[model samples]
Target: MPQVGSAHGGEPGLLTRVVEKVFRFVRLAEFEILFVLFFLIAFILFKDLMSRPQYNSIFVKKPDLDDRWP
Candidate 1:
């Protein structure tokens, strides 16, 4: 059987290397990453709010019954 810490025979596996690189990148670009995430979340929320009729009642005029029929 292989040793617990020697699963890859003392070499880092592909997944281990990828995870380490991701962590290192995140640590280096923490502020930029947070800003992007914040912007994306805010944009999604704004879009969702605008899509709801109740939220945009003041901005949009209600169609009359005659307009719908014609």
Candidate 2:
């Protein structure tokens, strides 16, 4: 994807400013921060998925479906 503001020699976009500030906080270089952000978002998504309830149903009492029909 093209840089928000840096596209076609234009000024940087809002996205660029936000990303630049994030990288500054993390003490990472501009280029490196993009990679880090990608991994961080992926990790957060994975962690969130793993934290959800694993069971679907609480309990279900159903009659046997065997061939015991009369």
Candidate 3:
């Protein structure tokens, strides 16, 4: 079978290979930075909502005390 990749036999040199690897790494790092920022914003919003008294009241369960607790 004819070698497909060898047709262009001009394989990238070391510098090209290194630069491609660096760019790939930087692309992944960019996603990681965005991921961190997204979660950071979400956490801040959650914290702010929880800090408000109204938000806390929404989750509070009122206890039945007619004759259930005494």
Candidate 4:
């Protein structure tokens, strides 16, 4: 009797091994990954929101005043 799949007997395929390694890495760095992603998404959203015309009104321009005092 011979194996039907994979040259290495019943071992997992290349993609399966790569996926497993990625999953393991993600599991170990889950918190760090989530934290980075959260900040990244927030930054992107903030940048997008600030680019809108409505947010520009939030900053009021100060009028120029004379430097001399009475």
Candidate 5:
């Protein structure tokens, strides 16, 4: 078996290298590209969160209508 931590082994495959290159290119792009990506994602998540109604306890029974003192 090849020795651990050797250059002959543990190298990323071609597809991985290509993906890394793509990520690097995007990372190196102008600030506008990153800003647009961030804003789009943030806007989508914020909209989704806002659209959901708050949860209510269905199992718990409401206090009796009578207003007797505790």
Candidate 6:
């Protein structure tokens, strides 16, 4: 493995070194990047979730398919 934080030329210890590489690539602070990335993925996922319109149980059901036409 190419050691972490090598790109920034810092003599950071293990934790700081990992944080440096992650911040470089992910564009967020070490403490916040995980939440940011998680929300980003969840946003993309829930974007697709928005169109799911639940109807009355006795009413006509819409064509629910895996293919998205939008």
lDDT of each: 0.91, 0.72, 0.84, 0.87, 0.77, 0.70
- Arrange candidates by lDDT, descending: 1, 4, 3, 5, 2, 6
Candidate 4 local lDDT, 1-70, one digit each (tens): 9977659888888899999999999999999999999999999999998888778657755455875653
Q: Best candidate per lDDT, number? A: 1
In the range 1-70, model 5's lDDT, one tens digit per residue, is 8877556488887888999999898788869797899999999988786666552234345677786955
Q: Which residue runs does candidate 4 get wrong by more than 4 Å?
A: 62-70
Which one wins by lDDT: 1 or 4? 1
TM, every model:
0.64, 0.35, 0.50, 0.70, 0.37, 0.32
Candidate 6 lDDT score relative to the true structure: 0.70
CA error at residue 25 for candidate 4, angstroms: 0.6
Deviating ranges (above 4 Å) for candidate 2: 1-28, 55-70
As for candidate 2, its clashing pairs are 5-11, 5-12, 5-13
Which regions of candidate 1 fall more than 4 Å away from where they truly are?
A: 1-9, 61-70
Q: At residue 45, what lDDT does model 1 achieve?
A: 97
Whose TM-score is higher: candidate 1's or candidate 5's?
A: 1
- Candidates 3 and 5 compared: the better one by lDDT is 3
Higher-TM-score candidate of 4 and 6: 4
Model 5 RMSD in Å is 11.2
lDDT preference between candidates 3 and 4, better one = 4
Worst 10 residues of 3 by lDDT: 1-10
RMSD of each: 5.3, 12.2, 9.9, 3.6, 11.2, 12.6
Local error of candidate 5 at 58, Å?
18
* Candidate 6 residue-wise lDDT, 17-63, digit = tens: 79878769767465577878899999998766664555343355567
Clashes of 1: 0
Summed backbone clashes in each candidate are 0, 3, 0, 0, 0, 0
lDDT of 1 by residue, 1-70 (tens): 6778776688999998999999999999999999999999999999998999888997988788777574
